[model samples]
Target: MADTAAPPTAPKSMAVPLTAFAVGGVVALLLGIFSKVHDPTLDGTTTLGYSNVLAMKTVVAVVIGVLAVGQVIGALWIYGKLPIKAPSWLGKAHRAGGTLVLLLSVFVGYHCLWSVGWETGVTDTGYHVPARTIVHEILGCIVFGAIVVKIVAVRSKRAPGWFLPLAGGLLFTLLIAAVLTSAAYYIGDNGWPSRA
Candidate 1:
């Protein structure tokens, strides 16, 4: 065989998670805007709270999402220009996005507890499902888990290639599920009061 220089690095699995984060970022922005306008109960709704939490949440989402996207795009660019070498920028964006997602998870988790503990009347419709708070707690836990796994897997040397993106996809699915469920509740006349 002719002499051939071996490629430097293996193909990284950051794309899956990064895409997930990017989708999540876009979904989060949409959810935040929807919550602010339609809910009328978010922090900055009235004159008293003046809370920037929602704004910051949206910002974080966008930052993390964009970073993830940038990572994937950067990797592609690197691969294109130097086909003989290993990918250098593969996980850079994903790492940043995962970190931001972790932060957001913390914020949301704290907010959940705060709203419950302070009796701030955080819930809008009283959540009428059986055991009332189940959805909140369950969804929050899942969100927490997804982010943790994504972060850990991304950092760990033992992580399989699919874990990163799978984690991200899970997060996006959770958000979308919540939003759709809430929207359906608002629209469907399934024994719920009309907001108008």
Candidate 2:
């Protein structure tokens, strides 16, 4: 006999968290980036004004760097291009990597308070934040979003591997953007114009 009950569909889990994290990553990346134009030091610093962890750009940079590598590893693992050895450690690494990026994202996000102050026309200058922070915030928010999705997936019993590709792609994109945008900003002027 044909089954009378309707088939079950996957629950709408990890959607909200994922979206928030993704958007957050982009926002963070952009804000961090564009704000650099006006205040280059904020892009990196050794001062412990906000978080001691971020006192050293090397620390934050290294972690984000690792997170980027983890993303690539995860992506490769998911696609079966890379061998999956010890799923447990890989999961732990991915989580740790995500946590690191999340922290950095928060650290970078601190500058956005200033960027938004200008970009939204809060200052005498129609556009306050330089173009640098724009890309920084965007990348940071994207990382934030990817982390959200990773956490949700982990909590929902989804393999940690699944989030790797998303994280990797976004991180890679941010890296490329960071370099290109920074170059362009410097070449054009102090930094790209928020409006331009």
Candidate 3:
């Protein structure tokens, strides 16, 4: 007698991706809501010996941006898109770089959420928030979501081959956008912190 085992169906194959999306969406939504609802307090805030919190955030953002660039290069090399041959340890280095990025992002994000909160346009002091700041805030939330999705997709065996690349690319784009809208703008506007 011949074996009659059935192949995986479309719905079963899609379960992991769908769950990843849902979890990512929920995380993003929760972060946004919490940031909006939380009261911002900048009193006695320390920037870990930097000139100020913005200086620390700026420096960290720049570092994150650079690391993100490295991550892209590493990924390309791993996937054989680069001309040079990928080293055996490249995968470990890539994972380490990603972990570093996540840690730094969380540090900056915590400061932003705790000290600044989410800003739409005007503040209580009648100060109009720049459009760039608003864009940065939105992107910040989405970037975390992208990170979650990428992590989920990367870990799941059931995820489609195309999903990981797509998630990674999206996360990279979001990271760059967040850094550009925040760190790049700050450097351009404030002329870079001397202490930072």
- The Cα local distance difference test for each model comes to 0.47, 0.50, 0.88
lDDT of 1: 0.47
lDDT of 1 by residue, 13-95 (tens): 65545554565455444443333344233452221232344333333334444544554445445446445554565556545
Number of clashing residue pairs in every model? 2, 37, 0
The alpha-carbon deviation from the true structure for residue 2 of candidate 2, after best TM-score superposition, in angstroms, is 26
Candidate 2 lDDT tens digits, 115-186: 232232234555476656555445544554455554554455333344535545655666445434433444
* Cα-lDDT of candidate 3: 0.88
User: Which candidate comes out best when scored by lDDT?
Assistant: 3
**TM-scores of the candidates in the order shown:** 0.42, 0.47, 0.90
lDDT-best of 1 and 2:
2
Worst 10 residues of 2 by lDDT: 112-121
Q: What is the C-alpha RMSD of each candidate to the true structure, in Å?
A: 11.5, 9.3, 3.5
**What residue runs in model 1 are displaced by over 4 Å at the alpha carbon?**
1-91, 117-134, 175-196
By lDDT, the candidates rank as: 3, 2, 1
| Model 3 residue 50 lDDT score | 73
Once fitted onto the true fold, the runs of candidate 3 whose alpha carbons sit more than 4 angstroms away are: 1-12, 43-45
Candidate 1's displacement at residue 90, Å, is: 7.5
